[model samples]
Every structure is written in structure tokens, then in C-alpha cells.
Target: MEQLIKELESRARTLRYRIVKMIGPEEKGHLGGSCSIADVVTALYFHKMRHDPKQPKLRTRDRFLLSKGHAALVQYAALAECGYFPLSELDTLKELGSRLQGHPDMMKLPGVEANTGSLGQGLSIASGMAAALKLDGLDSKVYCVVGDGEMAEGQIWEAAMAASFYKLDNLVAILDRNGLQATGRIQERFNTNPVREKWESFGWHVLEIDGHDFAQIIEALDTADQVQGKPVMIIANTVKGKGIPFAEGVASFHNGTMTQEQFARACQLLEAEECEGR
Candidate 1:
């Protein structure tokens, strides 16, 4: 368990620097939100998920959908780290003719199960996967990470209800509650507080934790797996751009550009974190 935590931490640190290095001037990135969920992605890809890098389409493997597709950098970093593709290809993010698009594409990418963007849709797709797995009698699980801002969509709730109604315990939804949306805080734009009670009302098991805390995340995931006759939802309270000192906990940095000096600073912080883990 200690080794898993250390491995996840090292991956999270490396992911941060890769994100920064990948984001140059006018770099076309989603730094704030992506960085905020790096730990969660790291934990999932490296420690939690059961997958084969050589055979991404393995039927019994766990499933993950980046519902908040704007944070493609997070998924890209994880994919690279997990050997879905070469890490060097990340340098071409958002570049024309590059396989790495701004959003995930299942057909184009090996590990990506679905093409996700335009919030509130991933849950429904996940529900379908869960339902099919149940029918096929496959012991597989589906995990979807949605943004707090994306919770405002009515479709999300509908999917939530359907998952509960069908008793899709193998389906897990994680909400990255970093407080801000594209324009403002979720409270200001469309308050979705009391998120726990709301999911409970829909007959789903709900757990909330600090999104960046590895221990808490693992605990919640364990609890999520124990839930039966219902689906599970984890509301992970996170800071936008978590590890970067200059960018952490702010909405503006979510999609802003970083200067070369700033990138170097970010790299330093990430490198220090890796060295500490060592």
C-alpha cells in the first residue's frame, strides 16, 4: 500500500511538469482543472485500474471516461505514463494532424473507451457500459470523472437516476468539485451544493473526499466498491491547478497560458516532489 501511494505520488508529480512543459505560450491547454485532478487520474491509472497496456480493449479490464473532456491533458498524461503511447507525442497536443485531439477519442486512442466532451453526457455512456457488463455477466467496473460545473446539466441527473434504478453498482461517478466553472464558481453560476444529499436522494451511495489526498481517495474507492443494489458517486473536493504554486486553487488558470519562466518554476516544484518521494 505504501508503495502504491509512492508510485501514485511520483506519477502525479511527473504529470504536473509534463502538463506545464506541454503548455507553452498561447499553448492551448486547460491547466487549472487538469492539474487539480492529476492525483485522481494518477491514482486511478497507476494504482486502481486493472488494464493491459498491450491490449487496451481487454473485456475484463476496468473502464474510465474523462467526462470533463476539456481536461484532456490529464488523460493524455496518464495515457502516456501507462504506456498507451509514447510520452514524446504529448508535445503535439492540439497540433494539427496530431492523433491527440483536444478531446478523447476511443477509436483513435488505445486506452480511451469513449470520446467525451460537452459535459453531462459521460454518465449516460458509463451507465450503458455498466448495464451491458451486468447483462454479459462480466466482472468489470466503469468509472467516470465529471466536473462540478458539469453537474448542472439535467441529463446528468437523469443518468444518475437510471444508474440507480438499474442497480448499477459496478458504475462509479466521480465529481471533481474544484468550485469553479468556465466562467465562475459553481455556486454562482449554478449552485450544486448539498451534492451528497442530492445523490442520496436519487438512491445512490455517495462519498466525499479531498480529491488530492491519496489515502482518502483509496478509502472512498474501497467504499464505492462495497456499495450494492445501487450506484456510487464520489464528490472529490479539489483545488484547481493543485500542484503548481502560482496556479493552484484558481479558476483563471484553468485555461490560461503559462510563460516559459512560469513553466520552469512549475517544473521545479514537480521535480522537487518526485525527489522527495524518492
Candidate 2:
């Protein structure tokens, strides 16, 4: 178990590094949100989820949807690492005609289950997929990653209510409560406070935890698996731009660019974290 945690931690750092590299210097990207959820995304693709890279559409395989699709960088990194496509393709992110776009495109990417990024719609899509899987008698699970700011969407609550009403236990929604969004702090923009109570009121099995801690993340996922009725929502408290020293909790980095020096320093920080784990 210790080894697995260490490996996952190391992999998370790698994913962060990939995000930094993908953005490079002076090229804007969704760095903050991507880094904030790196640990959870790492835990899913590398540890918790049952998926096959070689056969992305394999029946009975679990599905992952990045509803907060701006952070598609993290998912792209995971998919590339898992060999869904060439690692070199990451360089073409957001480029004209590139398969790796700013937001997820299920038709362009093999491992991506749905085209996301509009906010508040991912949970709805995931709920439908979960329902379909259940109807098919498949024990597959569907996981959706949503941003705290995105929770303001009315569709999210509707989907939440529907999931609970239908008892879609096969669906799990992980909330990246990083506290910051593109413009400013989520509280300053659209305060979605009392998240836990709200989710509970909507009839979800809620689990709150430190998003960066692999132990808590894994345990929450395991606990989520045992939830028999209603969907599970794991509210992961995280820091925007988590591993990068200068960017942490800075709202500008939500979709900001970096200087060459900043980029180098980000890589160094991520490398140092990976080495520390070793």
C-alpha cells in the first residue's frame, strides 16, 4: 500500500510536469485547475479506475468525464501516459486541427468519454452514461470531475437531483474545490459555500477531504465504491496551482501564461517533488 501511494504521488508530479511542459513559456493554459486536480486525476487513471488504454472503448470499462473541461490538460497527460495516443501529440494542444484541444473532444480523443468544458453539463452526461451502463447490466462506474465554480450551474443541481432520485450509485462526482476560478476567488465571484450541506440536501453521499493527500483520495474512492444508493460526491479541498510555488492560490494562473523563468522554476519544483517521493 505504501508503495502504491508513493508511486501515485510520483505519477501526480509527473502529470504536473507534463502540464507545465504542455503550456511551455508565455503560452496561456489552464494551469491552476489542472494542477489542483492532478492528484485525483492521477489516482483515477493510474490507480482507482479500471480502464484499458489499448482498447479505450472496451465494454465493461469504467468511464471518466472532465466536466470542468478547461483542465483537459491533466486528462490529456493521463491519457498519453496511459498510451491512448502518442505523447508527442500533447505539443499540439489547442493548435488548429490538433486532436488535443483546449477542451475535451470525445470524437478526437480515444480515452475521453464525453466532450466537456461547458460547465454544469458533465454530471448530466455522466448520469446518463451511468444509467445506460446499469441498464446494460454492466458493473462499470462513471467518474466526473467538476469545478467548484461550475457548481453554480442549475443543470448540475438538476442532474444531482436526478442521480439521487434514480439511485445512480454507479456514478461518482469529484469536486475540485480549489477556491479560485478564472476571474478571482470563487467566494468573491459565485460563493458556493456550505458545499457539503448542499450536496447532502440533494441526497448525495458526500465525502470531504484534503484533495492533495493520496491516502484520503484513495480511501474516499474506496468508500464511494461501497455506497449502494444515490451518487457520491467527494469534495476535495485543493489549492489552485498546487505544486508550483509562485502560482498556488493565485487566480490569474487559472488561465494564465508564464515567463521562461517561471516555466523553468515550475519544472524544477515538480522534479524536486518527484525526487522527494523517491
Off by over 4 Å in 1: none
lDDT string, candidate 2, 1-278, tens digits: 89998999899999999999999999999999999999999999999999999999999899999999999999999999999999999999999999998899999999999989898999999999999999999999999999999988999999999999999999999999999878998888889888999999999999999999999999999999999988999999999999988999999999999999999999898888878888
Model 1 earns a TM-score of 0.97
Model 2, position 240: C-alpha lDDT score: 96
Global Cα lDDT for candidate 1: 0.88
lDDT of 1 by residue, 1-278 (tens): 88888888888998888888778655657999898889888888888888998889899999999888888888888899889899999998878988788888887778888888978898999999999999999978999998888888899999988999999999989999899987777787789887888999999898999999899999998888888999999999999989888887677787887877887788887888889888
C-alpha lDDT of residue 196 in model 2? 98
TM-score of each: 0.97, 0.98
lDDT (Cα atoms) of all candidates against the true structure: 0.88, 0.95
Q: Against the hidden true structure, what lDDT does model 2 obtain?
A: 0.95
Scored against the true structure, residue 221 in model 1 reaches a CA lDDT of 89
